[model samples]
Target chain A: MELKDYNSCVQEWADPLFRFAYKCSGNEEDARDVVQNSFEVLWQKRQEVYADKAKAFLFQVAYRQSVDLFRKKGRIQYTEQPEFSGSSNPGNPDLKRVLERALSQLDEQSRALVLLKDYEGYHYDEIAQITNLSETQVKVYLHRARKTLKNYLVSVENIL
Target chain B: MVTLENYEEYIISYVDGALNAAELQELEAFIAHHPELRSEMSAYENTRLMPDTSMIYANKEALLKQAPKRTISLGNWRSYGVAAGIIALIGTAILLWQHTNNNHVATIVNVTINKNTAQAPVGPIAHENPIKKDKAIQQPVIAAVNHRKQARPGIASAPGINRLTVNDHQNNTAQPSQEKPEVNKPVEIARITALPEPKTIDTISPAKVLTAVITPNETMVADKQDEKDPFAWLPIDDTKKQGLKDLKKTVDKTVKEVRSVTNNLKETALVFKFGKKEITLNF
Candidate 1:
């Protein structure tokens, strides 16, 4: 990887990687920090890494950083949303808000799997590469997460 | 019956596009038969969530501002290192050539001195060592030395043999024995060097020179066959004569080998080309 290519890598991946880090870490500062760390590592290992592998490599690094930052904060397990809203007199319900809440409920790995599959349209294999999980695990975890989201919607619909 | 519990994995695979063509057709056929499972598929499809891209990333510029700088590859350094190594090699070769500019000579002479007190028929002491004025000097034997510290070959640790050396130039040199010799000295000196073989023993050019002999014996006895008195100067008794024959055969072989190896320096000569009148000086 040349210096020019390094700059190109930053230009190409900065936004999507930041988005991934932002979604994983749930904090803008931590996400920025993760993105910075990933690029710094990419800089250090420029010779070994090829241009094609840069995106996967960057995401892999970001995933690890996000996991570490989460673990360091002692937030390994996610604070799941309630299965159904207990509040009576249900008014206007936002599906996007419900989806965000559902996403926030999942643990880091599952959340990353869902984000990679849904938002980025990554294949099971691509998600596996990013999250350091097997393709089967990515598929299974993604399905389980979607089921949970459906369950959230179900609970919200039941309340309605 | 395709129940929801038995094939929920298949349902998920269908929604995620992970199902192969056969599996996808099988699922479609199964759902076609059971329309309720089609609703199950719709439930799965509706729950396929995508995050809001606009809201997810809040600070892109801050991350962009801290981008990476490039590193120089190991390949770049290797070329420079190789170039420096070649230059160093060339420099060392030039320095070595400059250091060793003078003449290169390898000479070895082996002389056997007889312990004869009988002061062999005295004549003009042309090559006599002034240091050993008392000793009888018969013939001047040129025993050259090498500057390089290589041990001279074919040397015997003979007791009671006196050793004297004088670098009086030319072949007028001799190995003088002890002051008072109780027995007759049997001096058998054989020298092999880049110096051309002398034409005859009679015309030895008796110069005012002196030296002792050590050893690299390859005496061309056949080359100097014209010498009427080759072995006459160093008289050998019956025992010494037998030893000389054996020694001469060994010296002949060694001389042939040395000549083959030291082919570079062939008899250092001064060629004087005075307008077609060429005069060669063999040293």
Candidate 2:
């Protein structure tokens, strides 16, 4: 792709890619690094990637980088839970925080599949392409991740 | 397709929006029949995460790529040609300047030597010698004075020998001499004894003739003679000396510049042609 197309991709996809990386990695710094490295890889291979495919290429690179980081660091547990100053009621508890805690419960690959699938609204084949998995595997993995999240939300003790 | 056995898959697919319209309606019917499972479907639907729009890449500008700059590569023959031409032009100019400077210095040295020689006292004195040419050549007055000084030392100290005389017989024999005389004669004798003296010539000691041959006046005249001066070949003017120093400095600077240029050129490949052979130099 040309420089202009690459720049346009940066402007258009940077936020979404960063959000995807953040959700996958669960750390702001790691997510930022993944996003930067993804663009850098995109620039190096700009000639081979068309303008329309740049977003997928960027996400693919980000996915790989985030996975590599996760592998290198092993499993990271979310220890610093945000404090809720008001009611301790499970039904009235903050859903965003509950969902973030739920996302943190899944493994790195499963979490990435869910993020790519839900956040970016990628199809099964597209998630498979980015994650280097078959469509059936993506579907099976994504369903398992969704079930895990659903189970976490269903448990009142876990939510409280 | 929407039975209780496969209902979980249907709910998951429904939450994922993977269900067709007819399949979605069938799942809705199944969910209506089993209304208690609708909460599970709601929980599954809540599992799909919405992206936090507030989270942005703060440094998006860093990823931009600028247009590449044009650079002149020495791989081109035209660049090499330009560099070689510049070096050749500088070399030629320096050679021509040095050639002209050397010629100028040579001309100045020649003129100064000729001018000093022309102003010398030797020419007029030699032509005006009154002693018979054959006798003067045979006696060789310098030798005669040396011989007389060795034979009779007392004559060199005589009052008559020191006295200035215009027509003294000793004066004429000593007048034309260019070498320093053996005896210590007064400067007046050299100045007065202009005509060649023939009277009392046999009575005079050779030391007096030797003493009269060279005087303080002639010593100064001899110092001006270019042939006798050791450093006469050097330029005499201070400005000319400074010019030579400046030329030397220019040559040194030019050499350093050429060396630097060649050093820079070493980064590129160079080709040389000799007869039918081609030699390529790469660094």
Candidate 3:
């Protein structure tokens, strides 16, 4: 890629990618790290990247980086800490807060599926491409993930 | 009754929108008949509207810290190596070149359309230790142009030794005949500049030059195509574009009204209401 062109791409996609990374990792520094690594890899593979394919290219790099970190930390397993207050207090008036806490209770993959589908509003095909899952699998994962979150939210309400 | 275990797959498909029209109808029918499942699905959708405070993973920084720090330094070295290679190649070409050295000198002269222009000094010789004199001379010229392109516009302002020496030579050769007229040219250029023209040096800076060179030709073509096809660059469908245009116009009108009221805040604040509370601006 041309030097100026790459600079423009960084400007356009850096913030959104950082936000995505921040949501996944829950730390600003790690989000920055993911963004930095993503750009570094993008620059290295500049030859393979065309202008139109640049967004997918950066996203793929970031997704892989997030997954790699996730695997390394053994976060793929299902676990939670009752000691923690979770992402929100049980008294928060906003139902959105309740949903967000419910979402965080799920495993990394499920959380990722929910975020991609609901928040970023990716189609099943796009999520499949990014997550390297089959379109059918994306549908199944999203369905299961959403159901789990729904169940978790209902449980929280019942306890209240 | 649809048991939760038997209906789990359908619930997922229903939320994910993978179901066909008939399937959707069936699911809706099931929900209509089943109050408990309907409540469950309502909770599912409420989860969608959740405020996302997802944080970037924390240990990612520590892991990245564990990785080598030399990547940036390595990249810098790679670029430096490529640049050094290009300089060496051009250096070799100059040494091997047998003729046409004067044409090269003339091309340098041709660059100055305005003869009396106060040219900046040429920069330092790029190839520090040249194997040959001819190569050394040519290397500076090629590198100067390349450097100018990459460096800031003001970088060449600090004239170099080579430029000072060249200026001395040009003064001796062309001085007597053109000296008077040349002295007056800067004054005339300065006078023309002083005129109250809307477009001046500020307007013709490198940014505008680059924009004129690049954007307009492409934009002109796009505009021509757009005249025949209105939705060319727009992502919205034609029907949607019409709706969007009307919406935009309405928004603009409302924004203008709001802005006008804001601009007259002191006067308008007398009548403004916010729920049960009302406040007045003293100014």
How many clashes in each structure?
16, 4, 12
Off by over 4 Å in 2: A79-81, A84-91, A157-160, B71-283
For B70-123, candidate 1 gives per-residue lDDT tens digits of 777889658655755565556545643543333222332333222231233222
Compared with the real two-chain complex, what DockQ does model 2 have?
A: 0.58
State the DockQ of every prediction. Answer: 0.29, 0.58, 0.13
Question: B1-283 in candidate 3: lDDT tens per residue?
Answer: 3455656667666666566888778777877778777777777667674324453333333222222354557885686567656655564355324222211111111011111111311222111112212222211121112112232334233222122112232223333323222322211000011112223111111211110111223322322332243333687433233223323333443455445434554343232234564434332
Better of 1 and 2 by TM-score: 2
Model 2 / residue A84 / CA error / Å: 5.1
Candidate 1 DockQ score? 0.29
Runs in model 3 with CA error above 4 Å?
A: A1-8, A74-93, B1-8, B17-26, B49-283
The structural similarity of chain B in model 2 to the true chain B, as TM-score, is: 0.27
TM-score of each: 0.46, 0.52, 0.41
State the lDDT of candidate 2 residue by residue for A1-116, as single tens digits: 99899999989999999988877777789989999989999999999999989998999999998888888888765546667766677457777788888888899999999888
What TM-score does prediction 2 earn? 0.52
- TM-score (0 to 1) of chain B for each candidate: 0.26, 0.27, 0.17
Q: Which stretches of candidate 1 lie over 4 Å from their true place?
A: A74-92, B1-3, B55-283
Better of 1 and 2 by DockQ: 2
**What is the C-alpha lDDT profile of model 2 across B65-144, one tens digit per residue?**
78788786757667667766676567556644543343211101000011122222222233223332212211111111
